[model samples]
Target: MKTTLSKIVLLSLWAATTSLFADSHGDHDWKPLFNGKTLAGWGVVQGYANYYVEDGAILGRTAEGSPNTFLTTYEKYGDFELKFEVKVDEGLNSGVQIRSHSRDFGSRR
Candidate 1:
């Protein structure tokens, strides 16, 4: 009975350790959304902001009189994981949108 209990405990420890490593270094089938040279797969909406590629980064500049604009992806996704980096000036507000949609509501009143 002692030997049997030892073997069971050892097996449990091995399984727990294996699962820890597996969860830490999970299977990540990630794909790059930006090509680092151009905005090939992106589109601009509302025409109130400007987006361009500079130094391998997509930059968005706010226009003075324009409304809120979006530089969005042309393709829609149901579930996804995204990683990004942003550097903005003081008091600048920026964000990333996921699982979103847009519709034309005619002229603004």
Candidate 2:
């Protein structure tokens, strides 16, 4: 009887661990936005600021006499989570825009 109970407990523990791993695997379906080589699906607008890829990172440098530059995605998303690492110089301000819109001059009819 003792051996039978021990076998049952071990089986239950194994099943629980398997289920935990399966659940964790199912939660991850992340897609990367940057390709780390180039800005394939991103765009910049309304400024002279420069953006480029170096050392496996997207780098942006502010240009003199330029308006506020924006690096935006081409695609639209309703809801999502974004994760990134940013390093900026001191006394400079940076931000990320979400669910933004641009005015269309041609639509004025």
TM-scores of the candidates are 0.59, 0.61
Model 2 off-target regions past 4 Å? 1-28, 84-90, 103-109
Give lDDT tens digits, candidate 1, residues 3-85: 23323333333333233333334664444556667777777776556566655555565566767666666765544443333
> Candidate 1 — which pairs collide?
none
User: Candidate 1: global Cα-lDDT?
Assistant: 0.51
Best by TM-score: 2
Which of the numbered candidates is closest to the native, going by highest lDDT?
A: 2
Q: Cα RMSD (Å) per model?
A: 19.5, 19.7
> Ten-residue segment with the worst summed lDDT in candidate 2?
2-11
Q: Which residue pairs collide, candidate 2?
A: none
Per-residue alpha-carbon lDDT of candidate 2 for residues 3-104, written as tens digits (9 for 90 to 100): 233233323333332333343355654455566578787777777566666555566666667776666657665445543333344445556566877653
Lowest lDDT 10-mer window, candidate 1?
Answer: 2-11
Clashes of each: 0, 0
